[model samples]
Target: MQGLARGIVVLGVMLAGVQAAHAQPIKSPQDQACRDEARARVFSTPDPQGVGPYVIGRQIYMACMQRASHRASVPHRRAAKRVKRAKRAKHR
Candidate 1:
């Protein structure tokens, strides 16, 4: 009886977690591109047997996202130029 009750509680918690969790929509076109590429790369290969393909695809997606984040974090060229000019000129 106790085991069954614990199982029921675990099931309820799992369901609640799944219901509460949501995907963070990617805002940039670059992220969308990464997702599209990941999907294509993952789905292009036929794996009718095991979960290897899905796992590999997830790794690829993570790597792509890492790259996208790096690229997005870089400041614009105009902003960089302004900073350089400011650094060169010291106000009295």
Candidate 2:
């Protein structure tokens, strides 16, 4: 009876955990490229976590991502920067 009860509890916990487990797919080409670059850089560099010198793959990835993000927002920034002039010739 105790063994059966434990099995039921484990099954219940696993079922509950299914909802929380999820994977986010890469959303853009820039993101995919960044990931590829990071993977390659990390592999080529010495593994600090394993041996010695730290890898700068993460830095490469982040810089690329930030640049891409900034480029994507440029249009919106330009729009926000310009305000339309209002004419009051009628009042004059």
Candidate 3:
């Protein structure tokens, strides 16, 4: 029916919006501080033998961002890990 199709589309749009919202990394003040310190440390260090400073800086920045985001998601990560382990054990 037309009404049922419209309801499905509306539900899909709402779910997509929720997914997009959760996909964004929620950075805390501590995470920002950690990333800033990482940037400073990276800049202070000399570049590797063949790599350019810019490339090195980019890599450091990416790593710092990952670390900071992971720290921010610690609770979520722990819950996921626990769920995974439980599921795995149940199958065995």
Candidate 4:
């Protein structure tokens, strides 16, 4: 039982780390909008009996979330460019 518990904990930590590494921080209004839209789409589908719609729904939801977050990050890319410009200006 102890060993099982430890294994579960390890698995949970690893999963969390992977999620953190892959997750893009959503900072834009459009990203938020996309996320909201995706959330709606994910839940819109009715669960198919026996096929386990909950499980499938979760997978879809995660994909939608990723897409939404990616969309949201587009605007923030300019911030990186601005930082590079500033750095160049400082050196000049």
Candidate 5:
């Protein structure tokens, strides 16, 4: 009976961990605006390279997207750190 109880507890803890890890990070409004602006800028410009305008536009859009995304995800990163610290404290 004790063994069974221990197994169930372990399973519950594992599921909780999985749920936490799978939770989606919330996107900030600024991130959305940044992406929208990048999209518009890329689409509005003519292909300067001429050989492959889309490729150049795509590169520019992606660079903008990454920078904005990284900035916007700062809160998520901080929350993750807090979670990690809490878990460490719990274990100790």
Candidate 6:
């Protein structure tokens, strides 16, 4: 009885492996060449440089603001609320 159960389990595992193997077919030579060509084209272009000092400075300020916002504490949040209230009060 034990041997029969082991055999059934082994047969089930073998069938599952066969199904998985058939699910993905091997790529043909033409398909492989097309994939390689696509990869080469995607990586061929070089990145462009920044234009001038003003643009570079603005980018740096934005990056600093983004980092500061991400690392801000509860105190910073309260200060931001106060600033917004002050701006609204000036408009009124």
Candidate ranking under lDDT, highest first, comes to 1, 3, 4, 5, 2, 6
**Better model by TM-score: candidate 4 vs candidate 5:** 4
TM-score for all models, in order of appearance: 0.44, 0.38, 0.37, 0.44, 0.31, 0.27
Model 1 scores a C-alpha lDDT of 0.80
Candidate 2 TM-score, C-alpha based:
0.38
lDDT for each residue of candidate 5 in 1-92, tens digit (9 for 90 to 100):
99999999999999999999965463766546655665577666677567464465557657877887787667767789899999999999
lDDT tens string, model 6, 1-92?
99999999999999999889855453555444434444444334342573654345445444545555566533667778999999999999
Write candidate 3's Cα lDDT for 1-92 as tens digits: 99999999999999999899855363677556645665587667787576876567667767777887787667877788899999999999
Name the lDDT of candidate 6: 0.60
Between candidates 2 and 5, the one scoring higher on lDDT is: 5
For candidate 6, report its TM-score. 0.27
Worst 10 residues of 4 by lDDT: 49-58
lDDT of 4 by residue, 1-92 (tens): 99999999999999999989966788777656655665666556676664564465556656766877677667777788999999999999
Which parts of model 6 have CA positions greater than 4 angstroms off?
Answer: 25-92
Candidate 1 ranges beyond 4 A from true positions? 1-28, 43-51, 77-79, 82-92
What's the CA RMSD for each of the models? Answer: 7.9, 9.4, 18.5, 11.5, 22.1, 19.3
**Candidate 5 TM-score over all chains jointly:** 0.31
**Per-residue CA lDDT of candidate 1, range 1-92, in tens?**
99999999999999988777744578888778877887789967666666787576776778898988887898789998998889889662
Worst 10 residues of 1 by lDDT: 18-27
Q: Rate the local accuracy (lDDT) of all candidates.
A: 0.80, 0.71, 0.74, 0.73, 0.72, 0.60
How many clashes in each structure? 0, 0, 0, 0, 0, 0
lDDT of 2 at 89: 42
Best by lDDT: 1
Which stretches of candidate 5 lie above 4 Å from their native place?
A: 1-35, 43-48, 73-92
Q: Once model 6 is optimally superposed onto the true structure by TM-score, how far is the C-alpha of residue 26 displaced, in angstroms?
A: 12
